[model samples]
Target: MPKKRVQVVLNEDIRKLGNNGDLVEVAPGYARNYLIPQHKAVFATPGVLKQVERRRQAEQRRLEAQRQEAIAFKDSLETIHRFRIERQVGEGEAIFGTVTNQDVAEAIQEQTGREVDRRGISLPDEINKIGFYKAHVKLHSDITAEIEIQVAPS
Candidate 1:
């Protein structure tokens, strides 16, 4: 006998299946046992599908607004020459301590009036000297921007 399949609306994003408010087909057993029990999905009846459409529309609007904000932030970063971070300098031009991702994120937030997650900042190498370095900011999945960071003695 052919495996039973059912259509449902996802309440949350699932890696391989679909995103929240998406209509998807899955095995009946999986949908009833896992998705329904976990409150991750609901049967795609006409009424529920209408609700899902509304939710999807709202989510799209929110995402679009975020993308626009991200684009403006990227433009601001591109216009900036360098972001200065002050640290104690040891003998020679070496910094007393390493500059971490959190340091970079904080500096960006201070200068740009925007908050960036430390995980979104990509460092090419360990910054252990009082000098200049480039850090890549992942603003969105499809958008990235590079910023010049200057480490100077306090």
Candidate 2:
């Protein structure tokens, strides 16, 4: 006689098996004695599969909506285009302090009335002099905006 296998839906990730919400086949003994008793998985039934499918669809829809919102924000930031920062100068055009991401974020907030995370802003190089520079702001994982930065002597 051969051992029987049963189908079950994983409640969470199981090593060398499958991830949460996945339907996988395992030994009947393991499913009945261990996985089911431990609340790690449930027998794969028609109703359970349907419920899991619904949850997956809902999650996909929510993520798509969030991505769309991020796209709109990126467009708005691009429209504004430029941000200016006034820094104290020492000699020539060299500024006394370096231009940091925090400064750029504040500039955006002051100009557009929108709060941006400083950690998401990337400066190309050191902005220690009065000049025009470019900055890349990551609004989302897939969306980025380029802004012109004008550094001037205060």
Candidate 3:
């Protein structure tokens, strides 16, 4: 017999299934053995579907607001010509410590009043010297901006 399939409403995001409040189809065995017991999903009954729909609407509105904020932040980020980081200098223009992605994220937050995850910042290379460099930041999945970073001797 063909494997049985069941429809479920997701209560939380599942990497393979779908996002929270999404209606998805999966094997009955998987749904019953894991999803239902774990409370990650529920059978797609009429009532459950209605509830999921309401949650989806709320999630959509929140996501839209976040996207707008990200866009505005991107605009502001583009306007920034450079960011300077002061570090102790040694011989041959070498910095005592490296300028890391976490440092870049903190600098952006301090300068722009917006928080950025360190993982979202990409450095062209390891910053071991006092010089100007370009750093790319992913504000959102679809929005990216580049900023100039100047490492200066303190």
On lDDT, the candidate that comes out on top is 2
- Choose 1 or 2, whichever is better by TM-score: 2
lDDT for every model? 0.89, 0.92, 0.89
Best-matching candidate per TM-score? 2
User: Arrange candidates by lDDT, highest first: which order?
Assistant: 2, 1, 3
lDDT of 1 by residue, 32-139 (tens): 899999999999999998887787789889999989988988999889858899999888888987888999888988988789988988986878888899989999
Kindly report the root-mean-square deviation of model 2 from the true structure over all alpha carbons. 2.4
In terms of lDDT, the poorest run of 10 residues in model 3 is 48-57
> Model 1 — which ten-residue stretch has the worst lDDT?
49-58
TM-score of each: 0.76, 0.83, 0.73
Between candidates 1 and 3, the one scoring higher on TM-score is 1
On lDDT, who's better, 1 or 2?
2
How well is each residue in 1-154 modelled by candidate 3, as lDDT tens digits?
8877899988889997799888899999989999999999999999988887787789889998988888888889889868888999999999997999988888888898878999989997778999999998888888888889999999
- Model 3, residue 100: displacement in angstroms? 1.0
